[model samples]
Target: MAFNPPPKMTAMAAAAGTYKANLSALQLLMRGLYGGAYIAIGAALCTVCSTGVAAHLGPGIGKLIGGAVFPVGLIAIVITGVELFTGDCMLVPLAAMMKKINFGMVLKNWICVYIGNLIGSIWYAYLMAVGPLVSGHADGMLAVNAFGITAINIAVAKTLTYKAVGAAGMWSCFMKAIGCNFLVNIAILLAICADNVVGKFFGIWFPIMAFVSSGFEHCVANMYFLPAGIFLNHWHPETTARIGGLLQHFGGLTWGDMWLWNELPATIGNIFGGFFFIGAMYYFFYRKEVPKG
Candidate 1:
């Protein structure tokens, strides 16, 4: 069959979640580390491909280009069966709601995967900063390239911009994250609905593209994006000067700002969006329709 009905898809999701919940701690962490690195690869590709694109092709086209290429990571994860924290934000909760997994199991999976993702993302960020972002330049020895500047700009925008608006900026990040994971979990569901590899690829691709192009915030992707910026800024003070104005208000990017301003709020919002909006809602809508044995 090419596609499963909603009830079947929900059942499949529950079964998959149960399987995920049963994985040992080490398994979850190892799978999740790969998941984080995969998503970072897509994020880095988006940054490099979209650099200065807006200047020549317009902002909308730039977003479209980035969105088009960004799904490779998620597609790879879905196909390879790596554990991604954002997708788990929906799946594990759905399993708990269906009584296939307990809430404690859910929490355990989340904590392990989240930590693994963080470690993987930061590790990739360091590699990217020292490698492609500067093209093998020694730290503080060479001028930052356009890609490096873009990385710093992304970091500053995601963090300090929100800090400037105080509460409202945080709220904006929260809402964007909600939108992000809603589409992400939808992509997960769509992948579940498909029986073939090609069907799964398109299923995951569209929603992810929509989320990226629409300017939604994704916590896992930001795990790579924000830290890459911070690493760049630390190594190249000259790049900070290039960014100018916002520097004074935020006092430059720090690890503190990255978590407090963007990652924390985005994580909370992703949980709400994935767990409640997509997971619970779908379960309720399809529960009675699921075939009983």
Candidate 2:
């Protein structure tokens, strides 16, 4: 027979329950990091498809390619499971701010996941741009893709990159990108928070659709796809130098000009856009009724 415990033993049980709650919070944070990695992988593949499709369809359809392919990645996230930083950008930050999770745990999850997503994106970009597989598409994929995309496409990419970065050539364009990201984040978070699967799908798919169609900035996805284009371009040293020189001569661009000038500010803009538009707003508007931790 088991011995009966004293009153102090009941206190120990409460302490153990508290410990378990904290542990569960930690687990949720890790889930975010894992999600980030998978999302990056999906974006990398999407970029490969988009880049190839854009090459064939022409730059005019690049926006269309973005609209179609990103939803596929989001499906991969919702149904099949992929790490998605954008979704977590809404979820994890909200959890952290609400003190539903410890700060160290939240930061750990975000940093690890962000780094993993970056690595996955770079790896995929390299494979898509330089790897033989990308060049192996049907109907002489290699020859046309190379010939059509080379030289001419760089200018289009650079222009898009500028709007993406934040040096929007005009404030109106920058605000547009910011607004695009805001709705995208709101949609993603709402989809994830929705009770039903269909609700989730529409929430994610439609907003992503809007952003892509509108040519908005998605810093995480861009973080993966853009570098791949640059890496593949860098494969031909002479072309790289000529391209670099041409950008300098005409566009007044340099090494830092590409990423720092465009990617960094865009990245900052994305964070603000997501936080204010999605996470904070939802917390204030929707979550006010939810019990406080």
Candidate 3:
């Protein structure tokens, strides 16, 4: 629980290093796309599964199930390939400004990665909703079918209550969210700079655990998880009277209600949380000499 600030880059060093990542424009674009796809998928799975555990087993056990495992996606996002818009967009420009990279190049990286991430999320969301893999399991309370019933589970809804306490209006709520996500980005980057796996895992775990425990919103995850779960949950009909319980047992309001109320605000929070507040603030403080990590 001690909080350590992420290392800073000096303005002169930031300008001098200017390593072009050795990746060409096309490569950078692909890296961005890949990073976005991985992160989006990771977020969706972590959220849906974690929330499902909570809903089925009760809060304590759910938290334990969600907490105990390491999501290797964190490593995948970094090692498996790609410049995550959530992270690289934040770091690259800072590096360029610090003299570690060129401003135009970093901006190019940000634009390509950000757009690619959006496309990937939309694709992932669509597949998750209409895919045959889920349709087969939706018919039965099948074990292999967890993803079918899991879209809207306790994962995000409880997070709503947690957020409402913070949402004293957007500014206060987003302020808290920004601080939390800032720390998360720092932890993630530091983990990468770490020399060993244990160092890396602990580095990643610290921020991730805090973000989860504190219940901050991750925008991209919401993009995939919320929509996917809601779409799957919508198969039920209140008019049929048999209603498949999407209306009543889906905690009364159904997935649609959860999306409108919870997802929207949380997303706004995530943007304010990770991008504007955290990213922008760090950019402001950036000395422009050291590498971001």
TM for candidate 2 is 0.67
lDDT of 1 at 227: 93
User: In candidate 3, what are the lDDT values of residues 1-293, reduced to their tens digit?
Assistant: 33324443223223312332435777766665566566556665655556556667777666545543424445666555566555553455555545555667766765676666656665676676676325344546422145545554433353334344444533443445565557556655566456566666677766766665555555454555555555554543222233233334334334444444554555455545554555556666655433445
- Residue range with the least summed lDDT across 10 consecutive positions in model 3: 8-17
Candidate 2 per-residue lDDT over residues 45-102, each given as its tens digit: 4444555556578865866765766676666566654445555555556665555666
lDDT of each: 0.90, 0.52, 0.52
Candidate 3 regions exceeding 4 Å error are 1-29, 55-57, 67-70, 100-107, 130-147, 154-180, 233-293
TM-scores of all models? 0.97, 0.67, 0.65
Candidate 1 lDDT score relative to the true structure? 0.90
Best by TM-score: 1
**Backbone clash pairs in model 3 (N, Cα, C under 3 Å; residues 3+ apart or in different chains), count:** 22
- What are the per-residue Cα lDDT tens digits for candidate 1 across 1-293? 58999999998898888999999999999999999999999999999899999999999999999999999999999999998998998898888888878999999999989988888888888888988888544553655678988888888889999998999999999999999999999999999999999999999999999999999999999999999999888877766667887865556789999999999999999999899999999999998887664
Over 4 Å off, model 1? 136-140
Report how far residue 174 has shifted in candidate 3, in Å: 3.4
lDDT of 3: 0.52
Q: Report the number of clashing residue pairs per model.
A: 0, 6, 22
Each model's Cα RMSD? 1.6, 9.8, 6.2
The Cα error of candidate 3 at residue 268, in Å, is 6.2
User: Alpha-carbon error at 48 in model 1, in Å?
Assistant: 0.4
